[model samples]
Target: MNPVVYTVDLEVRWRDLDAFNHANNASYLGYIEEARVRWFKSLSADWAGETAAPIMAAVQVNYRRPVNWPETVRVELFAERVGNKSLTLGHRILSACDGDVLYCDGHTVLVWVDRGGQSVPLPDAVKAACAG
Candidate 1:
């Protein structure tokens, strides 16, 4: 298992619940996105709106179990791979009440791009910051 480099604790909102009484499938992505964005912010205050920002190239998620409301969720993020122009992030979402219950796990590929949307090598600062 990859070491958790960053983490965010989130509550499963009432609106996030589905007809089955568990968090909706789409809500999982939002949870992971929150953690990912926070990770970038930790790297730099201006990372979110910088001229050369990173964008998601692809995402793969595996749902392991259902999550219900009233339970806190812990999102763990790890920097997996850093490439010339991209970085892969590994993530795990688990029930805060019991860390052993993994609700989901996934990976996201992010590509650095300039304002013009042309691919560019990740800034040295980002590369160094995310090195694990």
Candidate 2:
């Protein structure tokens, strides 16, 4: 099955800019987080339930180009790897107006954990969702 790709469009707010007048590096992560959350919600599963939740284990981001204000950025996410206890999500940030203009790319690793913070196998529903 083809992996599901999730996309979200976000406006570059003025507050997201830094001294260079472009979006701050931290802002890019925030954008990715928003898109990731939205995607998780779309799955319609209790991925963040009290009994078990997915926690970020690692994150890697590569900034390709600066993003200016008054622009809309499209954040795309897809499952890169779905393991027994962990999932790696690949992401790309591109100009919504000009899709060819890529701003950033990255991946985040999420591990399922129980209430005691011990790693657990991912829920079948989550795996099915990732499988698209």
| Model 2 ranges with Cα > 4 A deviation | 1-4
Task: Please name the candidate that would achieve the greatest lDDT relative to the true structure.
Answer: 2
Per-candidate clash tally: 0, 0
Alpha carbon lDDT at 39, candidate 1 = 81
Model 2 lDDT tens row, 1-132: 234479999999999999989999999999999998888777765868879888999999999999998899999988899999999999999999999999999899999999999999988877887877
Listed in order, each prediction's TM-score against the native is 0.93, 0.93
lDDT of each: 0.89, 0.90
Residue 123 displacement (Å), model 1 = 3.0
Clash pairs detected, candidate 1: none
lDDT of 1: 0.89
In model 1, which range of ten residues has the least summed lDDT?
Answer: 42-51
